[model samples]
Target: MKPLVVVATLCALFTLSQQAPSKDKCMCELTNSEKAFPYDKLGNLEGNAVKCNSDVTSQKARKLQSLMMGLERRLPELAKDIAVLDSENDEQMYAAISLQLINNELWEIQRLMDELNSTTLSYQRLSASATQQLKGMRGKMGELEAYDSMQVVKRQQDNRRLTRDLQECRTGHQHIVQPTRRPRGACPHGKFDNVTGPRVNTAGEYPGSYKYGAWGRDPRPAAGTESWYWRVMLISSNKYGHYVRLYTSLSSLIVGVSTPGNILISPSNPTTNTIQGPNAVMYDGALYYNCYNQDSVCRFNTSTKTVTTVKLPAGTRYNSKSNFCILDECYLYTDLDLATDESGVWVIYTTAQDFGNLVLAKVEDTEPPQLGQPRRTSVYKSSVSNTFMVCGVLYATRYIDRSTEEIFYSFDTSTGEENFNVGVFLHKVSPNIISLNYSPVDQMLHAYCDSIMVSYKVLFS
Candidate 1:
């Protein structure tokens, strides 16, 4: 019924036919013993050697017959079971084969045992060769495992070293990154009311703390009893301009000049006949200021009280809208629409913005001398809308630390200097001020705190 069974049956029929004695046996020729000896190489023997070979074949054939008989009985039952597995499902096909394969393997083991008995000496050689080959294979397998383990260890160490080096390099770079240093020093506070260096103190008595503002520039010597050393000035909150009031020693010496009252207030609007204030600088007895809502710088003669206007460019940040201050030869002031960290300082007379930029040009001369843009400098946290110069250094009131107010220190018109920082706070007392201004007569520094101003006289060796 099955192809394997049909083939096996046909092979058995052929084997039986070979064993049968044929009637044509008279036509066959018999070979000698010597010829039969060489027949061993041909795998076929008919004489003495054939007898020996036949004995081995007979024994093998007997064992094979027994094994074939056992397989024949078991294979049929296995086939019936396999048929049941196939009927169950395709997935059970492998299970059926596995179950039947044990019988086939048993049959093969029996056949191998028979062959081994027939060729006992050759079986020994095969076993010895197989054992040697197994030993060689085991040695190669051990070497591979050892090499793999060493490679793993080396890779781990290399990774750790690389990680450590990377971390060290990162730390080193952070340490050396950007270089910054804290600025150190003090501000120079000059002696008030003493006349040794600049102001003449012929009044003999020092005046206490009082509010005195500037009106234009009062550059007059002490004379009559009513004459004052400084003038009181005011910037009107109602209008965008400045005004001046004279505070002579004569007023204080005769009637005792009243402070908070001695200063003048800006006149009410629509008073065109009265003078409006601008930033003023006194040079050779001439006071210069800007008129109300005007771009031209106006000059006032102190001796004759004559007024004249000079046409000038409008300020950048101040379009008749901002306050202004004066340095020696330049007008130092801010502009309109000022930037927080980058406010503009417009120097009108000498034609240069001192703080943030340094644009220097002559106001009257037609020949422009290197008229270029100012260099950039960052401002402190607090806004520095005003500044004053003492000695050669400039002091601007701006924020240094975010928590407190500070005065920034710097010297303009210097060469190759980059250090600028918060110099002093109004609350602190010190032995040294950065740029101290002393009175020409009695030298002392006046430190003001609210209403009480303290005078310190530094006797420097």
Candidate 2:
């Protein structure tokens, strides 16, 4: 029965992970329990991707990734699908569906196996694990052939929901379209041209102690604090913070105003609802940041003193799995960047499905808050130093030197066109820009660079 459970769950999750990525993936408290599902042996499937040979194996590994994306979605449906199949008096249909599930996967494996036999350089494909999976699959193939004569496919479809789902697992992996383009929205502030200045640069009240965090003005504020600015310093391991400091104006943020208004995430325990990573954004009197120790976003309303959350995709990389990096070292806990632009608020991060390429999700300004249609980008997350969205376009920057940063790439979510040479350079007051945020209302790009806060005048065309 243990083996029966494993086999049925695998096929079911393959069906579940495919139930439409954007529309269905907002686990939002309603589906939090599903996040605890364990992958068990299937966890090692991604390990094979790392062992891929650059020639033929690389192409096949990508194919496997596509199939796994479908698999990851249905994975949560594992238990229910298993119950559907396991309810039978006898689990005779197991071998048939296993063959259906493993067939397409075997085609890719068999191709690598052919390559292994032909080239001496492909010795890694001949490992014991690979050989065993192939051997077991071949045995299932022999069993599946007899089921064809028995009209098993037609019979299974007549009575159970699990049958069609198992069949989808066999065929659904091949035709997934590239989700690179996003529908263009209005960019009233105009297209980005250049950014000037380290206009207001200074280490705040904490001085050089806090090296990584985010500070910026809320493009849409509550009432009369249009000139007000906010700062969130990642005081714990450059990754977590328990509070956000508020300044009445830009001068106060630059001069380190003492007794600045402070908002604590939790009154009883500072660690609860603490900010995670080097990036966060304050919008409409609420603070949005990566939820502490979880792959979800936490929204803390300053006025109500209440919190709400939105969970990212199951495959989203968090807790520093995909952070910004340069040639020297990577920034820790710099995953899940929150940005504000002329259009609205958005979150930028990467997922395993996109092969770790950057993914963007628009955050709606509702009471409980919800995630909008997600758009995928071709840019790799770790390849850039920081990112900010302006007028619905995402711009990525990389480290240059202590006095400069280069805006080298841009991805327009509206048309899915990628421009590799934006070539806009930003003058810096400090070496590293840990967090970069664009505020549409003021038309300013605020940067938190190595304990210093700086603002720039964004020049648009």
Candidate 3:
């Protein structure tokens, strides 16, 4: 019986050990809170079958409870990590949006810069085109002014030629129609008594006759009574090319009578100091004349025998080469044509301020000769070859021929009337009359004609 009981206990123990593995597997499935708990750990607990029922189970429960407490403490840290990841994802999304916006702004700025550059280039092209147009207009305006000046010169020449022809035709017609026979010895000696045309007084109240005079010998004045003097400027073959010789008697020159007492004026250095123009006038015991190289008026005091000079205004074009009078206008160089009346000395000059028009000024005859304010006259646009003052009236001469000059214009200072139809002809015996001067005392016109001195006795009506 005892033997049979022993066999039953052994069999019961083997069966309990196999059955314990199933119980441990069931407890691990029921108590394991972690989803990733290892099955090998459960099998190891089953092999230790001595403590599988109480100690192993209690130990596993304590370990699981400790693990649960640890997991609870770590839960806040894990949640913080997840929130940080979400914040990083949101920051990355905002960064991508900001980068795209920046690229769009860069493209807009580049477009504006390109448009500004294009506008600047277009403005430069327009400025270049406008400058070229203005230059072309200025060139065309200069051409028109030159053409108008030429036309005025041509018209003046034609009018002078017509007047000369009419006068010659009338003189020839009178001689052919009515011939007057004169007896021998009817005319006085050294006097022209023959008359042509009607005996009409053509000089008209002036104390001078401008009829054709016969070519006679020069009337030699007596010595020590040479109130009327004539000065001639000639180029000498000596070292001084410019020399001025004062003649006491006009007839003495024609008779080849030269006196050592004649006054001779010359420059210390003729190379620099050159006398200009055939126009010279005597006033208040002084001889007023123009200088050639310098734009200056010179005064020679006859008593003192000293020279005084007055400089003209700056930019005054008073050169020998410049024409005194043009076709339609007289230049400032016309001031070389000096004149004197009962009032004072006068000068006709032009300035750039006056637009190249002639201006007349009266000199005060002071120590330095102060010039008054210039007066603008209507005689600027007239062909005045020479000018003279008679009874305060300025008469201008126009060239008719070598032997004739007509007083075709007059400016009356008293009335301010400028007449262009003054048709009084002055017949000269010698063709080359270089200088003409009228003396109020003698009522004679003193003319210097190419080394020959001549005088005409003026007949007044």
Candidate 4:
């Protein structure tokens, strides 16, 4: 009766999607997915990782409270199913799923605590609330561990937890994170190697004011704009933006010495096709991003100031249903992550049919935008913090700490090979990186981390 009451409460939070109980073997008896958790593929964030002092603004304290409240709100999503997390004995095959959800929630709680430590204020009340919630959930993590008989369930949740901790043992901030891994693919551009740079750029004009956004070079720059760099910051609740900031060069953008150029996507309605999530990149002469409040990608041309869009395939998750998360926290509305490579424009997303795994599509360079056949992968989107393309290889990163992000997985589109052995660590100048991108022409990665524009260099041989 308790379990039923709890499930009903959670179900009330979402539009009930009632499904008849499986009379056959439970969904738990399903095949052990090769993509199961504790992802053996990914390694930990270890090395002589650089440590930096956190320079977070006080305003972020309020943001932290809001994010924690959101985390509590999302808890119901984990308990909406019929199974109870603590049912003593029942058809509770969903225990493992519930456990994994708990693992993620705990990880996020710990991550938020780390964030609280970095902020200027000691919002003791806020910290206590988060601490109390964390206590309430940690026991569930232990129960999942104690129920080792359910190896399949425990492993799935453990793997997801392990995947998030991909950076737990490391220390750093969000700034410039560059990976220097030799691509396991045909290097049409150059032989890829380890990326390195003077990674720290202080918070942008609005330090900690806007926490989500992206910045990078336009890989396929038009005639006169080869030296330009671009940025798109999600100015509303870290979910939406209507403008793209411009810098004359990487130097100007980094030095904070020049007035950045600007392009408003729309003068009247900021979100007509404006940026929706932080995972956007500037390519050629246009800005590519998730469209406002939709499951689509928007391309805003810099010169014409017009917009072009391509609807993502059906079953795609938008409006934050499928967002990016690391061990610490989840970003909102990052469903359609746009990236660029030596090849062309691309979008990394997830689909319901793919079971929330990653699906990559090439945004074909054409008059009206075209999306290529989506190449699906078993790599779970929830496990990756950010992704980028280089020489047709898709690389995924994970959040490590206050000043670090780690590149832990790679998927080559050309070879259809997934490699999770790339253990590369990057120094972060902020607490979170909402957006990241790679520029082919300059061989650089532009990271929009906690409202600051940071730079890193990744060259191919």
Candidate 5:
């Protein structure tokens, strides 16, 4: 009976022990929603509640309650930290966007600066070019003004000389017996041959339209051949400069090959040493040309390769306004009207003292040729392009076109009479004839058209 009572007591004790909760086994079942309690409600801990059964001990529940209270206290700080982090992230995004905008504006500014620099450079270049052109124009105007003033003074002096000449003629008429008129020589009539001569090669060194030229028999030729030579002056298009080249033809003017030789005269001083006009002539062993803008004649000796200048009288008209004006503008300057006669070199010029009459002076063939006293005649102002001598008679030519020129005036040195009945025509090989020269040996007319040298044999009638 005692043993059975003890077994019952043991069973009762086991039952009581099982009924009470063990410390290690005091865990309670949580609601399905409360399983992820602390982590899920981290952002809003105050609004979250953890649910569990009453099987848990009072001590364990109290500890868990303390922990939950501590978590509740930290909820506001966590929320504040999150708010600060969001604010910081927003600030970083704003900074990145602002940086991109500033970079775009900087790039646009740089582009504008580059364009402004390019524009400034172009403007500077244009300004420099315009300044240079203005300077050139001013210089040309000054020269033109000087030329006009000279012409006015010359015309005034001419009027006074004419008054004196008329007075003298009337006073001498009563006392002087009328002289008998001398017999006149027959006028020269001729037709030109058809063929053109060889072209003159100047190596394109002195490139431009031909201005002045001279052709004649070479005073010094090799052995027995009659070598003829030509001197041509080319004016640069700029109108401020000129160059002279010597050309030689081995055969006669009837048929010949022409080649350019040495440059006899160059622009030594471009400002002052320009050749005047188509007034160049070959005499003896020298070439004579008028020096533009200067009162001088330049003589170049072919043998010595030396140049000598002879002074002309002051106030002598030899500039562009004085002669050789082919165009209406008359921008080209020419003054000395040089012609070769049977006697020697003759210069036909107009002086203020001669009352605008043409004066013909014979030049002595001395070292520096001496100019004789001029013989004044009635004014021959009919735009004489060129002058030549045939059998002691001086004939003047007038340029018409590329195909035609006319001989319109003539003067007889022996009889001192001027005739204007000339209607002779020159059939030109080319339209642009800058100069004309006659060769007595071959009876041919030599014409310089641009760079070409053309010749026409005369059929005298």
Candidate 6:
């Protein structure tokens, strides 16, 4: 019986030792241990394994409770951090967008500023032009009123004379009103003694009549026509009026400054006519001057001493003071104002609308010669110092001083070339230039200044 009991005990110990361990303790080695453990042995140990049952109890319940607590504490803090990051991202995005919008606005403002600047400049130019035009219009209106007054006075005088003449004719039985010939000095304004046409008589065309002084603006006489003529600026009439006296082969130059002097030449009847004073020029036996209205140029015959109208092209007007010039022939060179540039580089000096243009026209002709269309030369936009002509050659100077300005240009009817330039004060040096008979008769230019007359010889090749 004792042996049998010991055998039972040994058998039970072997059975317990043969039981499979729990999967938690042998996870990696379970597959390798599969052959070592028998399925029948695992079934038998299930009911008898008391120590294995206590050790294999589940710990998932404790772990799950701790994990829940940790998740509750950290998840809210993470959510707050995510919210802050989202807000910061949104702010950065907004800042970038705002910066872009500001840049766009600034660009627009700059573009508008450029446009406004351009518009302002244009407006300023337009305003200046309008102001100038307004001033010109006002001046013209005043001139028109003066012209109208003169016309009224002349008409009244004409009516009164006609009425008296008609009454005399009816009362005296003068064959039904035949107008009687009035004697000399009968008309208040000088009578038209004889209205004769232009005469081309060579007998009367010697030592051409007309003397030019400071204002030397006229066509020079042809060579061999060297006769001394006296120029007198009569203060007899209006400020614009003067008389020219011409006497040929006279020993003395009797300028009418003091009194009417004697003439030795077998005097043909000396003629007297009116001219604009101070700015008078003698050209080719005629006295040329700007008319009183300062619009047209009038030519008075030094021999006949008669005034004739010179019709110029439309839109042209001469000045009463400092405007016109003489080229060659009887041709005139007038300065006209056409246009000016943005920088005001070409500011015209004359009161005439178009100044600084070259107007070439004859002055001392009896009848208005059929001069072909006048040629309009250089718009010489800059100011001019002086202009003179010699032997069909035109001369001009831009500046007066020598150190600052240096150039002398001589142009002819055909070819023009700039010949020389020098550094000398042209203004300090006197312009003793005068109208010469063809070439300078004495090969010299004379100008009256500071009391006495200054004369000098100009070298012309």
lDDT of candidates 1 onward, in order: 0.35, 0.74, 0.49, 0.71, 0.54, 0.37
Please provide, for model 2 over 78-110, each residue's C-alpha lDDT reduced to its tens digit, 9 standing for 90 to 100. Answer: 443454445534345433443333443344445
Best by TM-score: 2
What residue runs in model 3 are displaced by over 4 Å at the alpha carbon?
1-228, 236-243, 256-274, 324-335, 355-357, 380-382, 430-432, 457-461
Model 3: ten consecutive residues of lowest lDDT: 192-201
Quality of model 4 by C-alpha lDDT? 0.71
The segments of candidate 5 whose C-alpha lies over 4 angstroms from its true place after superposition are: 1-216, 219-225, 238-244, 247-260, 266-274, 326-331, 400-402, 459-461
Candidate 1 regions exceeding 4 Å error are 1-227, 235-243, 250-286, 309-315, 320-382, 399-405, 414-418, 427-461
How high a TM-score does candidate 5 get?
0.49
Error of 4 at 414 (Å): 1.0
List the candidate numbers ranked by lDDT, top first: 2, 4, 5, 3, 6, 1
Tell me the TM-score of model 3. Answer: 0.44
User: What local lDDT score does residue 447 receive in model 4, on the 0 to 100 scale?
Assistant: 79
Candidate 6: stretches off by over 4 Å: 1-225, 232-241, 245-273, 277-279, 320-355, 362-366, 370-373, 379-382, 398-407, 416-440, 448-452
**Residue 325 of model 3: what lDDT?**
48
Overall local distance difference test of candidate 5: 0.54
**How much is the lDDT of residue 337 in candidate 2?**
90
What TM-score would you give candidate 4 relative to the actual structure? 0.58
| Candidate 5 lDDT over residue span 1-461, tens digit each | 99999999999977976799566665466665322323332333222212112222354434333334323433443454344444444336433433443443345345445655665565567557656655765665454445453477668879999999999899987787768764465434332212222222231233344443544453333454355565555445423334444434323122233354445455453545555666666766666666656667777675676667666665566555456434353324445666664456667666666554566667667776677766666744336666666655667777777577777777777777787757667666555556566665555556665545555444343
Estimate, for each residue in 181-248, the C-alpha lDDT of model 6 and write its tens digit. Answer: 53422322221111110111111221222222332212355354454433333232223345543443
TM-scores for all predictions:
0.33, 0.59, 0.44, 0.58, 0.49, 0.35
Candidate 3 positional error at 287, Å:
2.1
Runs of candidate 2 exceeding 4 Å displacement: 1-186, 258-260, 267-270
Candidate 4 vs candidate 6: the lDDT winner is: 4
lDDT of 1: 0.35
Which regions of candidate 4 are displaced past 4 Å?
1-184, 255-260, 268-270, 459-461
